[model samples]
Target: MPTIPGSRTLSGRVLIIFVAFLIAALALVGRLAYLQLIKAPEYASMAESSRTVNVTIPAKRGTIYDRNGNVLATSVDATTIYCDPTMVDDPREMADALAECLGGKSDDYLALITQDTTFVYVKRKADVNKAESLKEKGLSGLYFLPDSRRVYPYGSSAGQIVGASNIDDVGITGLELYYDDILSGVPGKMVYEQSATGIPIPNATVVERDAADGQDIIISIDIDMQIYMEERLSQGVADMGGSDGTAVLMDAATGEIYAIASTPYFNPGDLSEVEDGATSIKAITSGLEPGSIFKTVSATAILENGKMTPDTEVFCPAYLAVDEYYIEDMHERGDMTMTFRDIIRDSSNVGISLSVDEYLGYDKLYDKILEYGLHSATGVDYPGEEVGFLSDYSEWSMTQAYNISFGQGITCTPLQMTRFYGALRNDGVAVTPHFLVSLPQSGETPEYETEQIIQNTEAVPTMVDMLQTVVEEGTGVDAQMEGFTVVGKTGTAEFALETGGYSTTMSNRDFVGFLPNSTSSLVCYVGVDHVPVTGAVTPIFRDIMTFAVDQYRIAEQ
Candidate 1:
């Protein structure tokens, strides 16, 4: 071909343009093939993540029932509101709408809706009505899922024992925490694909797994008795002008707790109203120095050792001096002769101290304490059960020995004291205190083993007689009932101060006893803390015992 002037140059330019286009086209084809073949799985995954959602389906929590089949705790149907943040069109408006319906600061909701994620929880286990209210507003990107809320029917009744769960229905305290795994069943899940606007596409790939419901629990608590005990305890604490109180009623023979109550109890349904120490079951958790009531254990040890008889006489001074400590009787009295029986009936600190020092000895008394399970937890079925503190007998000084004889220089929970007394009233056999009656789901019955804590069965009767004398004509006289033979001991412990001395203005007063002649007698313990008087707790015991006797017909039995 003949080229004109500048034609050759134009042809060269055209050729250069063609070569550049060919190279660019080849690069484009290579890039497309590389992406479609080698990088296909990675891109596919990214696309799948944007459109697919995995939703958790919560399993229904179980119900808690009392011995009488009263519902103490249960779960109700609720809804959880979630959203696809990527699908949200106007996050500010949606956040304001959510705050209006669900009760929160709009800023907080706004933060959640503006998150850079496919999905996020707006509210978990919210009230169905509230969730529905928000849904009615037709907010885009919002979704609802089924959930459950834990509820307590009786409110503060048995609140500490029954415990409570969190917003996620996870148990966090008391029996609920103790039996969480069994109460919180396995959760299910749903996997599905959604559109850009977060709606499930028709015939989309969906997979689901079923949830397993939690097992129901039936505890040994008697709701009626629990309510009655709580009422009496609250009234008693108020009447005594005390800071707080705790009480327990148990079958003397079986150690099956019928009613356990603590004053200033918290409402499980509303934890916001709870005060410090209100959620603790003081009967099993708090350790306090039990005063004259511990004399019963000393008396039992003295008699069991075969070293002292009920008629054995000891001279009691007004006060016994040991190591710069003068242990005086609750009441001032001149030196007098007292029998073992008299020492207990009068709650004579000096006499019991002499008896323990002269007869029971430190090692034997400590041995007896251990034998009665005073050094360990009662093996209660509830959570957070604390045992009494007792330094080894080898660590005791002479003054400490005498102090312990009359319920000082040592500490124990009210439940431990009740269990010890129960052994005395239960023919020297102590049964493990328990709240679990049966697991109906597994058809399982828990074993409550009995131990011969007081080996001298014959000595127990004498101990019982001495306790009866306490109610008849002694410090525990207020615990006496007109046709009932009451056997109990009274305690007045000085509250220890953090400043290395006992509080002069406050004391823990308690009464523990049982009806001896009644069948299936209940060993009851009532304690009031921060009381000014030594005998403020006995009347509470009297009132509760009277009701129990009449309700259970203990006298007739």
Candidate 2:
């Protein structure tokens, strides 16, 4: 061990190696500390994701029921096919295998797998058997996710009102969309450490977060009545030979929507059948210049003005001159001295105009119109609502003032029309329409029995009496139901476009009445649009109410 030339340098090199190793060890320790302590949560999450495959288990959507507890909408289990490109290492092989089961989308499926994305859904909403078949093949890169497909137990029954859900198992339209927050519950997680063969690893931990399913919705819709309305209105649209139709029912006292049906309705389960017609709730969302249906507003105006009573007399000529304008009826009134009762029953444009001119004046007529819930959204629980157009006076023509009185020159939704009728039924209380009975079973219970939208409705009873005359002896005789002292009105609205003039081609056949033949009872409104050139649907309304009373054992009038 004698120190020689360059021998001492060997020892120095050894020391250098030792120091370098110590420093490297320190650096390694520091990095480990950072990963385990400073950023532990981030790393832990990433590690969890890599070690455990988390699949979504969609919670069952709640069943939707009508007021009588009839099932209108419900949710059932369905499986969908999806692919994880990372899992399916072989693209071409997997795509070809999928094509046989998927039906005519081989290249599309192949292109989908070859994409740079980690997850790609080749198909959704496939039948459970199809997903099971794909599962049976044990395809490496494919996955099956469970979802809830909405089933309208009463197909096209309350299609428009019940609405539809999306591929995500989320509600998209109707009450389904409106109450999504409640109808869509939390998704459950299924996590398991799996081997490359897709089998659960031995002794591996499975972390689970249980999902709470969506709560059921008990709507005020009456199923049997809804069926009857759809049948009747569909017939009415056919009878009137018009294009389309809508019918809405409301509880006069509570403002609950009993039934809202539109034909031809698109299935909430399958949208492929949807067409370009004004089906669904178009009668509410699509506003139109209603023909004689608007005379109700004018009648309200006249009655509010004190210039006319239900029995008050007014003379109607074939043509009445208001300012420089001549207002005429569909049929000549022949200058008859008609009472207000006769005015509505006769549906005399001349008589209504004369009453509007003499009693309502201008401002009073407009105020009465607003009071009756015209020119506003009915504020129902739904998406895509519009406020019916009520042009201000300065924008109004002399003809508009009178035309508005007769249900022309003004625009409204079927829901708004029902509200106007609701005001008449509820003794002047303009009730806002509602769908839900309570909140989700998981959420806080709602304060049931909500109230009214209209403030001053003392004049409603008087209007009801006048409207009753229209049914008892007036123009709405077609709306009367046997064994029921029906109080209602009929409106044959000639459909017109906003930009174009009155439509000579299409019209709205409407019959709205309430039954059990008593006061403080159910009020139903049926408005049919673009009737098929076949026949009248009002009789359907009578049948529906007639059936409703008889079915529910609501005492006959």
Candidate 3:
């Protein structure tokens, strides 16, 4: 085969080799042209992205303050410690030290760094001092990540109302949750390079947009008033042998809710010790069977119809007949004639029921209750508000009319009951109850605009006088204050059990009143379970109201 190489066969072989080489070169050129034309832009774009950098910057959340500009909720800088698993040396010492310093730690802190994991969070919400100390201690593989934590100065003081934020600084409850969108400020971001240590390059091209902070919210709530109400209600609930209760203070004229609180409540600052069920605003959001308090409406109906006055007489025999039902009063009295004032002062069940039946028939009684804002949501500023419980008029059972007369059948929230009484206090001018004075615009409507629900301009002197008698001469003397007069109503509604009749263990007790004439100044409602309704709460109402008058500088009594 080698001998023929110099012959024509060798020449032919060389020619064939040359032609194949030329064809291969042409094929390579054509492949390069196809790639350059079709996929050039795509590869160039990917290459550019690999060289570019992106970064994110946190927006500063808005500062929450009280009326006097005291900080309520705030954000403070914190350093989060993270460990690289492949760098730690002493497992036992690190675990013991972390468990002792950070608290609630039961795992090995150093062994975590000995594993294949790249990152491990050791502690959150640590300050510069703590992070510096940890760094100085020289536990390898540990690094600090910047973070922020929410702080509440007042402790558990206004926890439920001022509200708590989520882990990400978003509002979770109370006012925090209510104004979340406004409270959370605009977020800013940055685009830059990162080193192998995962730190951003200093003085690099950082795309920083200054974040806009959240606006200040001025609420109608008074911090001192809330403290006072909490103290008083806490004591009252304990003394009354009740597990939980609530008290609310409001302006009778403006429909401003001043102090609203519920027991078994929690402090937002320290939610760790708080039970799950202890943090709701039950005073406004929960409903209860309002007892004799409902009688005020019936008695008001009697007076409004000119069928009775404070001194108008009704013969009391302790029982009244309504259709097929025989309604009995708690107190069985002889056929003794008593004034309408006497009926209210005594909180007689039969008297009110008969009064409601006689003065205005079933239809009118229903109409007046609806007018007084019962069985309806007041559309208050607070969240989770529920419309009161009242079987519709058309669904009135045999015992419904009489039962509702003494506050047994119908149920209402503390807010609903207070708003109803607020109507009477406002001289029958129904207004929406509110905690905030103003709010940022949502869609087209401004936040918490005040509006009158019903306007009955004339002051019903008879209703005023009767409520006055309730405080000065009736069950509300326990509620009196120094240098002030209060008109109030009390309710002790019986609760039905799963068994039968009613349970003595659970009763919805209430005491509501306002200063001087109900159409003005201050008003409060105390909703206590298993507690006797007394006039003693009148002083609480008076003291808080008078203080509010001075604080807000309202018209002096």
Candidate 4:
């Protein structure tokens, strides 16, 4: 009765609809099976990534120690405070509270707390006292991470040399920059389960990859000598009313720098007010024309070529014309006959020109300068080292030759000069200057290699004797010590002006030599700039030399 008109057609239509529905459901089931069986691992990893938190563990930086095993730079445990700004209930209030406890402006904290990022740093390497104060507030959505901060125990002592690290613990300059790869240890990872809002779920299983700490480094610097040299050099600069100064002490035989400082000091601990260009280690970085100090090279060339002996005679006048220039003696008047040794002892410009041209010749003089490490970088293990400036001998005029012969017209760093002096003290065998003594390797002691620059061993003693005569009875007499044989040369040269001629008001007064009384040879170089007198730095050199001889227990005659 119900299926009257078109009842058969209606039933057929309903059946077709039912069959179509069943087919669609089967297709859906097949799709679900394919996903569950074939791609289970991929979907599982995607889900895990959304719920798990991965944190990086920074490696501990290496410790820096002086030659005597005194720790100069190290790392200390610290806490870094972080938070999810999205999870914070009231960012302004939280920032205000944090500012009161952490000693920063409230606006700065507000900006950090209101950031759109999921994670933001509130304070890194926080002080324990401040962190405890913030903890007492029991703030929500805030977390603390274990971190390490760089520390310099000796404060400003050797600060520029050791340098400083950035907030992320990357080295920026000096030895730290040079040895960054060796000093930065291996970083690690940590993963843990977290809630929807990014907070770690308590009691959840945690997996961590432990970080390997960096190796400890031992440098060749002796802190005692460093302190002494810096103190006296600072005082000398002040007393002489000079602008700046640099000093270096090295083991003549090995080229190991014992104490090297450039005034004023750079404080690595607090870098908020670091002066521009103040952190440069000028001993190896700054190059200047050394006045009479260069004469030693000429004197060496003269003797090495067999053109003159210490007793050989020459005539020195007040001034002499050469090429387009006139070379003059600094003080003495009238023509006088003097021994070849007296030329260097008196630091005579005319005498050097007469000998360098008449006897040593240009080719031999140029070769000797190259042998002294003056024409190239000293190959030091530090960053930003400079090479000496020397024109090719083929381009040399008579004036250039005479100027170089008298230590003018050429430029070299204080480190290069000290290295040359070291060669004179070490049997004429120049060594590559270096600061690193060892670096830890595979839990074993550090390894090292040696480099020699010169091979003429016999010439060392002869030059040493000649330099000794300068200190005994010449311009370097101010550097003389009571019981030690001080061998060195004094130099006073005006700064070359950028416009043309030399500066009338500024000069570099210097003394470079070694102490032979010590069991091991010690080379020292002192430079004072922007002063009127020439020998002002010699007394400073004397004080440091005397102290070194006494402190190191060097023998006295």
Candidate 5:
């Protein structure tokens, strides 16, 4: 056939343009296919977030129980009230209605309802009744979701030890804080579709992940014993009108704490009512000079080194000049010969100082103090435990050494001293004081465990016999129990002034005792601090120990 001069060029151009358009169409189709299939889930989530929100569901906290299966703390059902600010029709009116139903101020609710965001929490864990009241009004944009709040069953009993949790179920103090992660379980998640203005999309697909509840914690405390100690200590503090008082009872062989009580107790249910410095574990945290109670250490050191026997006699002077310091007995008896047992029974400050200095010297005395766990932390399974103070042997002057022998220059916590006495009860095996027996695992019951810190089995019988004499015939006569064969030591020390002296009026009176016949194996220690009255804590100790012995049905002597 025949073609015009320009026809061929124009035909070629038309073919090229057709090819380019066809390639572009195929490329566009391929890209669309890749996006719709390969990237579908990612884009879907992005779009869903624009119209849907993920809400967190808090899991129920684990139950806390005493050794006897009494509930100390637990989580109760509650509801959280929240709002999608964009969906509310009238911000002021909704706020006013919510304020009426709930207890919050109208202005606060009004501010939240007027927010430009998709969601806001009105109350994290509101009472169920309040949430129901709000729901009855059928307020737009507001929703009620299930939640949990911590509740204490026994009021203030064991308050400091069990601790408390926040509104969101997070532990803030005590064992609650110590075991927070184990107590606070996994949080759940839920995704729900909503409108642009934050209204729920009906019949929409909702994704959810169930939360796992926390593990239950079982501790060694006896609830009845805990309540008794708290009551008795509270009364003792009131009667003596002291600044503070602390008591701890433990299993002599196992070191498991049965009851630890402190005056100025707080209500864990309502933390707002806490007293000043009341929430601390004073028995484990507060360290003070332990006075005549420490004479047990001096006597033990003398016996342990064979420097003296129970019948070994020493001259007890009314005053002894050691270096620049003059050590004096509490009473003025002039100079008299006293047996080694008589020193502790009479609580002779001059006797202990002179005897320990002449016999065990400074290094052995300090070593014995540490041997009894007086200068170290008790390693209790509780927070705020302090290591009591003891000066190095290199820094000790003769006077400091003498003072330490009588429990004057050194310091020790109530828990440390309790464990020291506890060792004597357990045949000289010093065990670490602990509260947590075990944690529940795989739906099984928890078991109790014991950890021995030290052992000196031979010295214990002698120490026990001597201490029993203190209660039976000497200064600790106030701690005697008729049938149970109570053995204990007494302490009466002037409260040291922060500015470098001792308080003339206030003193720290302490008593630590144990029942030799009791199979339950109890060691009790009591300290009354900053009390103007003398002989304050020994009687309290006697009463508490008597009650505990009766409660446990310990066999009579």
Candidate 6:
């Protein structure tokens, strides 16, 4: 305890140093505790994210089959190549390798591999062999995942009906778009830990979910008949010098489509060659003026109202005047008296107009149009079915009535026209047209029950008799088949012009009918648009019907 001159000062300095050291030690310990306990999860998450990868696996799309189990559309196994750009050592080298294996520009692949993101797709749904070729090269940061590619085996045969899918196996058009949900199944996920070089760490954290495959669909189309119809339609369109053509063959009683085709077909497999407006199915989508073919409906209404019989005589002039508008027949002749049968046999526009004015008024004819489902869609299972254009009875003028009586000033799809003829063939009952035959996985079958469209059943046979006469002696004379009585009607509708009046130069020639005596329950409709001739479609109908009769071995009555 001896006090020197600087002893007290030195002791004070030591005490200050010790106090500062104690404070600093305590602060360091507290900081360590905070980091080790509180910030542990946050740091661990950051580390985990740096080394872990989560990948999505796409599910397989469904198969579309014909009624005979022929595959029209399906999904095939493929590979998807992806990569971690961060792990790629040389973007140019990898890009060059990919280009050689996959047939793409190296610069494009280079841009993808040089991306700042951790993962990017090199190619989706690549050909399996090509992907395998790249995998064998052992390119760094590259990965391959099992994928599916949509394939159409029949090509353009049923292209419009079956539709096509996009590169990612998503439906974009046709039946594919309609049933996309049912065809695209649930996707899966895979979570795995990997190294910084993009290699999986063995015995590390891994989680996976298996993908569910889509359901298969069976449609109500006979592929053989479809092929035949397409061939005939193409040839017919060429022969008639038509811009386009549509043909539909269906079960007369069931309304199940046997064959449906449209010309200028697009291949579902290769959409690049598809022309604009070629994807739409004209049978249900395009509405055309039905022309004299609609006379069958007019005749039916007249007989059903009991205002006229097949023998009911009406004076038919070359043309009938209706309030400054004259309705003339396709061909002009002298003023003559004609029975109801003769009017249909001659397809006389004047005769039908007179009968509608005297017997069936505009209001009743409008009612018959509604009753025949001409004013609405046929409620087919397919998408984009158009509801035909029909003015309300309240909106009808005297000229409009006359024009409508002769199948003018109105528009309807060929399928709708065919369905109306189907009602006549099916004893006044109109069956709903559909393409879905069955749902195999769910064991569900759609019921297409026949509904009575024509109230007076007796009028159906009388109308059928008149239609038979059309093929035998009228405009449909070319449609007559040997040893078969073809009951059909011919239509030559003037195309509407964009300017104002209808086009006198171009027309949509159509024929609709069914064999009354043949055992085959088939009704056919053939339409050629922009045809110069009047009866161009009748010969096409005759050819298709003859083939159908032979194919089905239809017994002659």
Each model's TM-score?
0.90, 0.82, 0.83, 0.91, 0.91, 0.92
Please list the C-alpha lDDT of all candidates, in the order they appear: 0.87, 0.72, 0.70, 0.82, 0.83, 0.88
Off by over 4 Å in 2: 1-54, 80-126, 129-147, 190-205, 277-279, 322-325, 439-462, 504-506, 531-537
Best by lDDT: 6
102-143: candidate 5 lDDT, tens digit per residue:
777999989877877888999888889888888998878888
**Residues 1-557 of candidate 3: C-alpha lDDT, one tens digit per residue:** 46654688888999999999999999999899878987788887676455445433445466666655567777788776766554566766667666665665546554554567555777766776777776777765565656667788877777888888866677888888887777777756655543455444467655667556666566677777778778877877776666677788777677777788888778887767887656668877888788888887777766667766677788777576667767776556766777788989888887777777777777777887777777777877666787767777899875787788788877778887787677776666666777666533332333443434344333255677788788777777776655556678877778777788787555666788777632245668887775543323444455556666666655525
Root mean square deviation (Cα) for candidate 2: 4.6
* Candidate 1 local lDDT, residue 284: 88
* 10 residues in a row with least lDDT, candidate 4: 444-453
Q: Could you report the Cα RMSD, in angstroms, for every candidate shown?
A: 5.0, 4.6, 4.8, 3.3, 2.7, 3.7
Candidate 2, residues 29-92, lDDT tens digits: the string is: 9999998899999987776666566667677778888878788777777776777676776788
Q: How far in Å is the alpha carbon of 277 misplaced in model 2? A: 5.3
- Give candidate 1 regions above 4 Å deviation: 1-47, 104-108, 196-199, 203-207
Better of 3 and 6 by lDDT: 6
lDDT of 6: 0.88
> In terms of lDDT, which candidate is stronger, 2 or 5?
5
Name the candidate, 2 or 6, with the larger TM-score value.
6
In model 2, which range of ten residues has the least summed lDDT? 445-454
lDDT (tens digit, per residue) of candidate 1 on 85-184: 8878899999999999989899999998888887899999899999999999998789888888899999989999998888777898888888898889
lDDT of 6 by residue, 232-261 (tens): 999999888899999999997887898898
